[model samples]
Target: MDSLPNLLWLRSFEAASRLGSFTAAGVELGLTQAAVSGHISALETRLGHALFHRTTRKVDLTESGRAYLPAVRKALQDLAKSTENLFGGKISGAVTLRAPISVATLVIAPALAAFLESQPELNIRLLSAIWADTALETNIDFEIRLGAGQWPGCQAEKLGDDFVVPVCSPFLAKGLKTPADLLKLPRAHILGFDDHWPRFFETLALPVHSPTPSVTVDTSIAALEWVSSGGGAALLLERAARPLAASGRIAIPFKEKIPLGQGHYLIHRQNAPPSRPAVRVTENWLRELFGS
Candidate 1:
């Protein structure tokens, strides 16, 4: 005879032993009372000992059943927790997310520390890149981009709208009075991008002229850093610049803002489901934070 009992049989035996009645165990376990009694009898026969003292008035555990109860209960508890950890809503794994430099710095990075604390078993790899190209790197679990909700071979959900205004150091804004005055100062424009400066001038109903930049940078975060170091005025996103401006890191020199009409979006592969729990949690958190 096998030394160990079947898992289901053991479960039935444990239930019957704890409840002190095969009928009560059957009700709890969704089994017939006869089935519960059979399981307990099989377990008792395998162990070569009677686990229960049958009685018409009330059933009771024999000394052997009492001794075996704690170990079986603990085993069942461990199995339940292990099953939950494997297949339940609680997740443990790494998620790779990619986004623009400024969004990574101003938006995601600020809230990430707390998020990691809450999900101790989860780890993340955040990459900073321009969202201009729709073709993201392979193996990227998630992405944040600025565009209409139409990326070929991917899924896109609109996060929210973004706008920009001219910002500079306090010293740079000291003598600046109006939008016209901003034109004469050496402006900092993002290289390979004409959206902010041209749209800004067009919003003011002025002729779009390419003004020479004191410094041309590749990313918005770099441009903001330059402006903070007294480089020159830069057109920066309103959401990203607000906190810095409030902290005196950078000052918005103009009251006018140029709206792009294009919204930010969360991106992932088309028809690809998020298999990892961490990915689902992070995606939900981002949607909550950035959704209008």
Candidate 2:
């Protein structure tokens, strides 16, 4: 017998040892039970030792098999990962992306057509959250965030500055000529948790205390819809509200704009390698959209 055992035989033995049955290993490997049993027997004979104690009902690994299990399992895992990496797994396979709901709806959704056109082979899965709630170590490939430039232990790229301004329907814009005129109208506030309206009011010189809004919403998109429906005036990001603004659904209430404190950014774990398809799609599309 040759000193070196067959790789296929070792694979069969490892699967049988972990599953505790040749029949189960056969199911997993897509082989017949007899084939699996023969492979394990061949491995044991080549090594001059019995790897498992087989009975009519079940199989148990011998002491030598137990000692060898960990190394074999780790080797197999490493080989599998390497094979996937070699076969464009990181680029063509599933890519999970996380982003804020507003950004995902307005920015990413509009730009996705171009991305899909360029890289048809890649599959993208998008996850939207109200806040930065995604666990980066999980299956997520990347995260797009709206914040000041400071994400620790991650590779960050600033997308664009998020600017906010008061937006109202054309019907509501009729009497709203000055900043003081805003006090007479009902204002829509996004309530669950964002400082957009508060920060916007701070930019004006007038002593305008935030009114207990007539309509309170949980999302920027919802607030935009309310404004479009002629419910009330809402303060929304210029980028997110641009589409509606262009369509004449909503109008900017004031000539002066307010800074919303931060910009949109794309982030990924520093230790993790970036997915090639994700990087290519994001960079090219955002550059075209934002002219950055």
Query: Lowest-lDDT window of 10 residues in candidate 1?
Result: 269-278
Candidate 1 overall lDDT versus native: 0.78
Summarize candidate 1's per-residue lDDT along 113-156 as a digit string, tens digits: 88889888888899887645666566888899876779888778
Q: lDDT for every model?
A: 0.78, 0.74
Output candidate 2 Cα RMSD: 9.3
Give the top-scoring candidate (lDDT): 1
Clashes of each: 0, 0
Candidate 1 residue pairs in backbone clash: none
User: Can you give the TM-score per candidate against the true fold?
Assistant: 0.63, 0.61
